[model samples]
Target: MAQKNIVVIGAGFAGVYATKKLARKLKHNNDVTITLIDKHSYFTYMTELHEIAANRVAEDAIQYDLHRLFGRRKNVNLVTDTVTTIDRDQHLVKTKHGAYPYDYVILGIGSEPNDFGTPGVKEHGFTLGSWESAIQLKQHITDVVRRGAVEHDPKKRQALLSIVVVGSGFTGTETIGELRDWRDQLAKENKLDPEEIKFSLMEMAPTIMNMLDRSDAAKAEKYMQKRGIAVMKNTGVVGVHEDHVDLKDGSTFPTATLIWTAGVKASDQAAQFGLTQGRGGRIAVNAQMQSQDDDQIYVVGDVSYFAGNSDRGEPQIVQGAEASAQTALSNIIKQINGQAADVAYKASYSGFMVSLGSRYGVANLMGIFHLSGFFAMLMKHLVNMLYFVQIFSGYYLFQYVMHEFFRTQNDRNLMRGHLSRQGNVLWAVPSRIFLGAMWLVDCAYKVSGKESWFVDKLRLPFSWLQPAATSGASAAGADTTSAATGAAASGAADTATTAAKSVFSLSYQYGKDPMMVFDQMPHWMYSITKVLIPNQQVAFFMQKSMTIIEILIGLALVAGLFTWVSGGVSVMFTLIFCLSGMFYWVNIWMIPMAIAVMNGSGRAFGLDKWVVPYLQKVFGKWWYGQPQSLYGQDTVK
Candidate 1:
């Protein structure tokens, strides 16, 4: 059988999920191959772009590596290129790099900001359509604020500090909330008055968050107003200039930054495909998400116009995108197997969730449950985690949680400006190497002997003590015989053998018996350890295994690999020793030192400082928690 090549374009929510579904279904089939193409090598979590722009989260937090996403799938091929056009006659998708021939093509190219022919808007305003754009917006805001902080002229400073956000939909509202919080932080850090900053959200509609319930929308608006953000209703931006924004109502706002989140239309690539364009310049599709002109071509995501149980059209939300993608992939697979395209696209609206900032949110679940404040914020995180787990790995979920919930303002401040210039490596390098060497020496000594110290102690109480004693006795007997000829030499030998025997006997009594150590422990700890390991044989095996593990940990620490992991293990070991009645004065100091090492002491001079960022770039942002230096530089703030 000839192999069927299925091409999926874009790596957004729709493209990603569709490729995953297709890969899973065709994993065992040798007759089918899936190819995924996207302009960027990484997939951006579009929903979280606002957080990036607000500086609430790191830019890397919203990206998932395309290579890693398809790394394990043998039948999936990933192409990082922009699609320029589609050749329907030859069944080929032409990209900037090359053309991919396909038996079927799934277009999930997503959407672009709609400037709506507003004069100077596209040239002067920024939109949150892509990751790069969000980053640009963030950097521009930072630059503006910094300039404002040092400006001597009040008018110029006000203009630099003022920010106008056009449109009060989900993106606009969320961006304003985050921007306001960020502005306050920036002002405090720069020793400027917070009152100097001006933030506004302008919408042409009667209410903000139009997709949200009326009560929820009102609550959101009130929350924004309470936080000192100007909420303008029925206000539309007619044009934007380099230093100010012009509203449709003949009002002008002097601002250096104008953010356009007014609306989104189908990506220009949709029209380039020569497909039947429908409302909003999206590709027209049937109930199954197949193009009206060709059954072999399917469209999904924001670029696909599908009217499912709605007169207007399906909402261009992540949930709808996923559902449409699923339906489209199902139909494509069915057609590949010479079966009918029976599955129809269904629209599902779980609810709308909007994060006001790190501390606040408003959400309506299933149109029945209303949530706000901290609980709503928690729910928002949960929803993000769910989607992350579905589309990416648990690493991304962990990163999201840490960035959203645990990372402090101080930590985020480290990520600002040039990260490559921060952190002192002088002490970190030597300290890590020295600590690792100590562990390695300890491990080597324990494993070098025919029977390790632990094993010797374990066998001492059983049968090895008698053999040791006999050996000592034989040496003493030899010493006695030699005494007949050379009394001085014989006496010295006898004393040495006697000392050795005594030392062995002491070790046998104390070392072999962990119970003796347990007796010295506090009653509370003693009872816990006793209950934990009631079996003597099991305890012996555990001791041996721990020794081997220590050896591995030592090697890793010495190599400067997984520095934090090794340090954490060292802490665990120290704690275990302390609880087992081995609490020496040195052990107490080791605990704190281990903690220091775990907190990125390796980054100062060790391999981790350099390797971590590289790994994060190649594998995505889920490598570890916030580093001491975010982009290889110290905290600028």
Candidate 2:
């Protein structure tokens, strides 16, 4: 078999993921090589550009290192170059330094901001297409706010503070939504009143968010209006200048920042190739995503115009780009395998969710169900997380979680500042140590009871070991010995602690010794108990083993050695005890403490600060054959 080269042009949502999918499926095929070429070292998460532009997240939050992504894949090759031209006849792609011939080509050259020949927009307006542009706009916003705070003239400050976003698409609406959060936050930072900084969204159509359901769009508009964002519908932007925007109604508004998110046209590379160009400079493609003039060349993403089965035949968002990529790649793979490229592409989009901000959103799922507020926002984040999981696995998903939840600024995240708690691991040290001390006390009591754990005839009262009938009889026998039945409500009666009434209106109490709170043990637990301790000798051995485990867990936690392991064991013990009816209301405090201690609590004043790294070095050598550890430092082989 002859070697086949698959060249993908861009590393955006479409090209990168298609290449990744190819690399995985054809990993063992020696006759194929998947080469991913891009101009940058990192892949910019384009959907998250609005978050960075509005200062909700840092610039690096939306960047995924391409080298880190494909480091372990042997069959995939990474190229850092700007593609100058594609020779369709020769099946060759030409870059500045070299030319690479491909058997099959995937064209994913992305879109650029469409100024629509509007005067001065290309020179004066900012567009959120590239990572650089987003960062530049973010800094520009900050500079405008800073100057507005100290300006002596009121009109100049007002002009400087006004920010108008012309377009009501996802990009425009989402950008304004994030800016809604930044409005008050940046105001305080600049020592200016938030009300003075104006935000306006202009749309030429009768309604905003034309991509979404009308009701959802209306709800989004209402949310913007409530937050002081001027939603300008049926408004046409005729011209954009250095300091003002001229509307179609013969009116001009002064503004320093004019963000243009109106429309996107295909990149110049599309037209330069001299293919069958369609509207918006897009190359026309068939249902199989193959170019009209060439069957070997497949075009995906925003640059490919497939004007069938879809409303407009052009996809602007990430979902459409990804779906087109899938369709294109599926046919490419089929053709490679000598099968008919018969996978027809059609548009069946699930739904759209627009976040008004980090805290609130409106969602229309499957065009049937509608949701708003926190749940909608949460659903929107879950969709992003799910997408990250699909394109890239745990690493990208984890990074998104960290950026959106823990590292997010201004309490503007999915968790709403709850998971943003930082610098508190040191404070958990006291709680971790205290919890370990209590476990040691319990172990001490178990060592020297009337019938000690390992001594003659172990007398450990496992509440779930016996049947319900036997347990009830034992409780009945002990009641005759209780002389006092009427103690105060707060006091224990008959040596049994009275619990709060159950939700089912069932009265239950924590038993002293002979009985437990749950009347019947679960079937699984009963079956396991029968096998685990069938005889006195087995029960005694099991009790001794349990005591040994407890002592080790307590000592390790107290010393802060392997706290993740010790804390996990403690949590397991806590869960088991609660399920077995051995834990009372007083013992419930261990659950949170167990969880907290596992989260780097031992790093502060604990042995795991030093121990985990050495263990990581050993584990690294054992697993990946490297002296340098995966999670820790380098050590001897």
Best by TM-score: 2
Best by lDDT: 2
Of candidate 2, the 10-residue stretch with the lowest lDDT total is 627-636
Clash pairs for candidate 2: none
Per-residue lDDT of candidate 1, residues 1-637 (tens digit): 6889998998899999999878888889999988888877778999889889988766787887765666667788777777898889998988876888899999999998888989887788899999999999999998998999999998888889999889877788888888887876888877888988889898898878988888998888899899899988889888889888888889888899999999989998787888998778988899999999998899998999976576557888888898899899999888888899989987777888888766677999999999988788778778778876776566667766666654545333222322222344456656677778878887776775766746735521211223344332222222123435584564467556545543322123543321222213444654565566545676677667888888887777677777888989888888867555453433355566666666566666567878888887666534332322111012243
Please, what are the lDDT tens digits per residue for candidate 2 over residues 1-637?
6889998988888887788888888888899988887888678888889999999887889988776666666787777777888897788888876678898888998898897988878888999989999999999999988988998997788889999999998889989899888998999999888899999999999989988888888889988999999999889989888778899999998898999999999988787676897878888999998999988888988899898865467667778888888998899889889999989876767788888779988888898889999889888889888876776566678878888988876788877788774546788888888888888888897788674676856464543333332342123212223354532221343234323423222233455322334433444664565567666677778888888898888888889988989999999988766555465544567888898888888888999889898987786455434321121111123
Over 4 Å off, model 1: 150-154, 188-191, 392-395, 398-452, 455-541, 548-563, 567-597, 604-637
Model 1: residue 408 alpha-carbon error in angstroms = 6.4
RMSD of 2: 6.8
Superposition error at 225 for model 1 (Å): 1.7
What TM-score does candidate 1 reach? 0.74
RMSD of each: 12.0, 6.8
